[model samples]
Target: MAASLIGRHFFIQSRNRRTLTLKSRLKYSSAVQAVSNEDVESLYPPVKPRFPPGNWTSMTEEEAWTRYEAMQEMTAVPTVKERLEKLTKKQMRAYRFPVNNKSVRVLEFQKNVTKSHLIKGLPTVYDSLQVDSLILEKIKPYIIEVLLLEKERLFRSRFRDIHRDSLILRNLIQTLLPLLYEHNTALRTSQVDEEVDIKGFWDRSGFKRVMWYDPEMERPKEFRIKYANDVRFQTAHVCDVSIRTENPLKEFLPIDDELCINEEFPVLEYHPKVFGTSKTDREKSQLTPGYNLGDPCEFGLVSFHNTVWLDYQRRKYGDAVTEEMRQGMGLTASFTWLLAQAYSQGFNSLLDVTYPMTTQTVLSDGQKMSFFAYQLNTIDMLKNNMANPRQNICWYTDETQLYEKIEDGKVIGFNDETCETLLKFLLMKPERRNINMKPTLPAESSDILSETEFISRNPLDLSTETN
Candidate 1:
């Protein structure tokens, strides 16, 4: 056994030595060598196995069809989910501009706005629509009958839990709209939507409407949709009553493309809504404008707004600031309604309107009403791209008094011009002016509407035709 063990040890050592000698010899022999082109060519025979050559001529019909299908598969549009994944961005916090955003109310940012400034902010032309005193007098007696009746209804309002101003405004609209129905047949066909959920976006580049945020107070926390991936004011101004019609009202004024093609516009330096801000709800953010250039929306003839948001504004900020806020409400509502309609029709901040859309706003506290006529000529005023020459037009007037006071149930000092103006707005018919509008609602593409539901919102009435 001892002899065997010693022999095995010697055998192991010899094997180790032999292995090392072979490894070293191999390492020494290994050297880099240049291969002749001839040797490399020999790796592949001239006649290789691919498709047996002359056996196949041109592609057959079946092969062509298969190839065409393959090409189509390769070039087809991405799936809806894939498109959404690529188009939608990470949820971002944004500024919301509610009709009565409390932050804006307290911040008093709108006090900086004026007629010319708003025109510049919107980059729109401005005009004043006023009746001559003599003309107002001539029609005063005829309109006074309805004015007195509206005043009576105004006094009869049961303010109850509702705010005084809101109630008065409601009563005034209820009493006055009927006169429109009696005067114009077109108005009778109009649809009235109350507290319509209005939402949209506008470039808040300060432009002519420059305003600074008060850093002393916490910044306002409101967010709206982004425009072409840019931060814009999400105008969610509420309309007390929106009168929708099949036809859009005629444009009050149209600027010639050549005349104002080189006109200068006001530039806003800062948008106050972005300052002292808070985090926003990313879930509500929607990408817009570029995709909605030609969609049709419900036409709004007249929108009524209430000064209820301006609570005690008269005393706290004084009449000047109060007036500013009032103008802001009317202006914001007017712009947002048109924008929302434009959005419905696929006209967004990224896409300007092909033709003008008109809407009238009545801002009131029951007694005094401020009227504004807005003609949205263009909406492509995004900060990065404002090359469009046409300016939007808004015709506005200071508060027109319906009456001075209600003395012992008798209306006193009723203004004839105010009544006349209000009636004219109500009488403003939706002339058969048609713009390219998508009959289907935006939400129809999703689960928001069914076939039956789509038809209801489908204003074009193509149901009878075969596809």
Candidate 2:
């Protein structure tokens, strides 16, 4: 019986060993399968390369047509008209002011009479006064028309539409601003091709040229630079649209009334010398003292933000004015006037220490227009150049209302101060003290101009040429 029991135990142990061998074989097989699966995944990855680097030939016409037809059936391509509609109407919400031929009023300035005509009652040999007036008058209508048209374009655009919205503003300055020079016989604009590259030209022009002084080197340094990606979008280059006016005023302001406009008033001459180029202070400057002349091309750069945030409010309250809008208009008007002065004086030298010039800025909020005047006393921009430079303009500005509002086309509640400011800027020349004498004259000319230099506080003080 003992022998039988031992034999049975040995049989059980043998069965157990067989079961263990079967389990080990199965485990080995599973491990091999797992490795094979991993290898398969590595060989055929899920991610497809977007641009496969191989010389693959084009598919056959049948395959191509099948794919094209499938795409056409799945989706439709939008029309150009639909795309343009989305861009203009839905994007900008642009509209225009009520303008027509009747909206235009011929602003007549009394034909400027010559001093000789008044004293001797005889026309000079060369009487261009009528021609100048006629030419100047023709440009006024053109200016008004352009301004009205641009306002329509500007007010309609979304500010973020940087390309479409800013295009007209840029065009206004680049294309239209030079039109003012059309009437002036003393000035002529270059016929710059629209397609020409002007980036290099603007970088060095007197107006756009912004520079600094490197104290370490003790020399004036130019910090203006262009990045590789800094490209203007379909905009005319500064050089392409820049108007370079040639003035012989380096020797004189024409004594002949026919050659000059409003000879009774002062004609501001651009100082021939370039200022703000010096590394040293004004007192230590070896160069003749003058204000750095600005380029005519950059003069008309008046920008206004198209505040998307205020659009809802503006729509709710039609023809309403906000503080932000007022501020923007003020800035735009100021820049406009500044450019006007720059363009006017382009033939004359730039402003200088010899004769300081004051210009009035008129800001309109479509409802009401305000006015502010700034006198450029100096352009020694390098005096305190750390990171930012100091503004060289002097403050002679007085807060005044230009018009209460515009009812139809007429100006309502026109402020006398507004009239005076307009007259001073439009009629009276900013720097007219040397109107009679040549700018290069060794002798001193008459000091008939009042001590105030520009517009007065009292509106009644209009007895001067500013009236």
Candidate 3:
């Protein structure tokens, strides 16, 4: 074995030395030089392969079919098992089924299972799902119907409540109809001669006369002629009737003597209901300056007949009483006669007197009397002469006065002074006297200034002296 090994080693070494010598010889040879350039070019030439030209241009149809079949056989083909495996993978991915255990796999499984179940079980589940959907749909409509019915019930309840309240209010107002009618009648009657349109006096309805005791005249007199519809119109259509006594002695004998007996006898005591307790004796004292006292003849025997003619002409002509009447009766007599005529014409209220009292009278028996006379020209004179001429005046005890306008038996004007005077008069000794006076000031006098002296003054300096 040793000898064989030695021989093999020698042979291996000899072969390697020979191979190296050959490679060296080849590296240095000219053949290698020629091959370096032309060998690579010859192996891969730029030109395409050339073939010999033939008379046949193309293969016949059967030959071509055989060639195509052989070429197809040469291409790769997948087996049925391989194709099945690929299709299975694609299906698994598409349906998102659990190939591996994960949340993604669970969600995929749930979606596929639910969808498949819904589609496959459609026939059995359809009726149950439809019932649930129908329940959901009907719920909203049913709730809305219930709400609407409840709202209607609430609205009807409220309407009935308001209707009941209105009926109650109407009944209450009806109960007050009589008192309102009577009060309104008295007001209209008192305002007859104030240039008020008597046609509209009673709210399109005629008046019902109310009778009351007249202590002054000692007779049962008609206090007011009231209209039925006056309450609705808020209007007064009262005519105060004063009965003229044929026997003055019968009415005045007892009362006059008692009142005249003592200066402090409290003239208001006789008619405690008509006049309240006296605040001061000054109201019952002898007449003050600018006031008339005593009987009618003490000043002058001025008959109503004489003054009636002057007033008639003055009212008709709207001018001064005639000179004949003035000379025969004098201004005082003419005015007195005019007052009597006005009083006889149902203007017996002191407020209805058109003229101021000029003189007072004293009788031999110590009885005191005062007279208010009217002249035809008195209203014109007041309109033309008074510094702040107004439609009417309400005289109070302290010479405080209310200027007002009388229209349709309504005082349409009012002012601070007039309102104050009215309030004072309402609070006077004879509280019943306030019943005859209107509580509200006339609307016309509301914004009127009692004097124009401020207007005539210098605006810049507001001084009394003129520039």
Candidate 4:
């Protein structure tokens, strides 16, 4: 019986060993499968390259095509030469001259008067007063007609359709004609004062003093004298006239009239000496010895002429005056000219014409020195005259183009074409730039502090301590 028990125990041990071997093999196979799977995953990674190099990745295909179309549209518009041709053709078709006329003599006389000024040396020989009178007489009807027609058209057109060129021309004519009339009238009434010391009066005032005998008075009893405080006064008379008032015995003459005699009032002048002096003081003060003799209105006109020349450069060569140009001219001179031009042109709003994301410096001084970059907004009056008027054009800031430049949380430079396109888009309407999303964080979420945090920090005992 003992032998039989031993045999059974041996059999049980053998079976147990076989089972252990099978279990060990299964464990080894499972581990090998896991490691093989891991190796396969490492060979083929999930991450991919965002985009190919040197191509715009942010814009979708549709968006890119849209931008390209806009660029083409801007370039496809008629050139200046084509526009000029069309305009000339239109004008020729619109107007017709009468073939038969008794008015030939009148036309001849008008032509002679207009041509007289163009003849060499004739302008210098003929009294400016006579020349101006003749010019005015010949053009008066034409001027009146143009003004009336323009006014009627302006009234008919919507405010947005108003053209800047027409507005500028109108302003120039309106400001100039009245002064010319006044000057001519003054010239007509003027008389040579044989007895009076004209030289002495002029020496005292630093200007030529002219005496005009009143037309109504007999024997030149009542006289009108006009003088200037400075030699530089050109269009502006600054007339300090000693008029024959009703009361002759009144010793000190009553201040006659403070008239801005220039056709263009507030004419820009370069007077380095007058820089520090107040306008009131400059008008009141007499020219003295050792004073700096600065450039007058003539100089201002010359400067304007130079600016016009520069404009021609821009139109013809596309060589516009940049920030570098401003630097070449002294800062003061550049800014002064800029302000004068802007004011003269009646630009109510100026675009800061700097690169995108650039900041401008504004002096704290009350002299209104503020540097801003913007695109010019232009209104077209001629288009307004047409059946369908184009909308007002304004400058817009391009956020999408700018966004592409933003790196490391800051914007760098902008593409010129893109900037120009955006500006043109803005010029079409009066609306502010549409962001389509909030630029700044909302008020509620901006600050980190919360009511729950404050309440949780309060001092309160939850359980009593054992004594």
Candidate number achieving the greatest lDDT relative to the actual structure: 1
Tens digits of per-residue lDDT, candidate 4, 1-467, equal 54456457768988999999998889877465543454454666666444322233334454345445533443343332222222223211111111111121222221111111111111111122123344445544443344344433446322322242234233433433353444333222222111111110011111232333334422223332333222221011111111111111110111121120112212123331222211122222121111111101101110100112222334544533322222221122212222222222222111111111101111111101112222111211111112111111111121223113333433345333332222221111111223311122222322122223545666787888889
lDDT of 1 by residue, 84-150 (tens): 2332344544566555543434223432221122432211322144434654465555444444554
What does candidate 2's lDDT look like per residue over 5-72, in tens digits? 64577689889999999988888774655434544546556774433332212333443354345334
Sliding window of 10 residues with minimal summed lDDT for model 2: 107-116
lDDT of each: 0.54, 0.29, 0.24, 0.24
Candidate 3, residues 1-467, lDDT tens digits: the string is 54456457768988999999989989987777542464454555566323222221233444334434432432221222222222223211011111111121122222111111101111121123222333334333332333233323334423434233323223322332232333223222221111111111001011122222333442124422322210101111111111111111111112223221222211111211121211221111111111111111111111111122333445654543232222222222223333333322222221222332221111000011112221121221111112212221111111122224333333333233322222221111111211212122232322212323445665576558768
Model 4 local distance difference test score = 0.24
Using TM-score as the measure, which candidate wins?
1
TM match of model 2 to true structure: 0.25
lDDT score, candidate 2, position 67? 39
**Decreasing TM-score order of the candidates:** 1, 2, 4, 3
Candidate 2 global Cα RMSD: 31.3
Q: After superposing candidate 2 on the true structure, give the runs of residues whose Cα lies further than 4 Å from its correct spot.
A: 1-169, 173-179, 186-372, 378-467
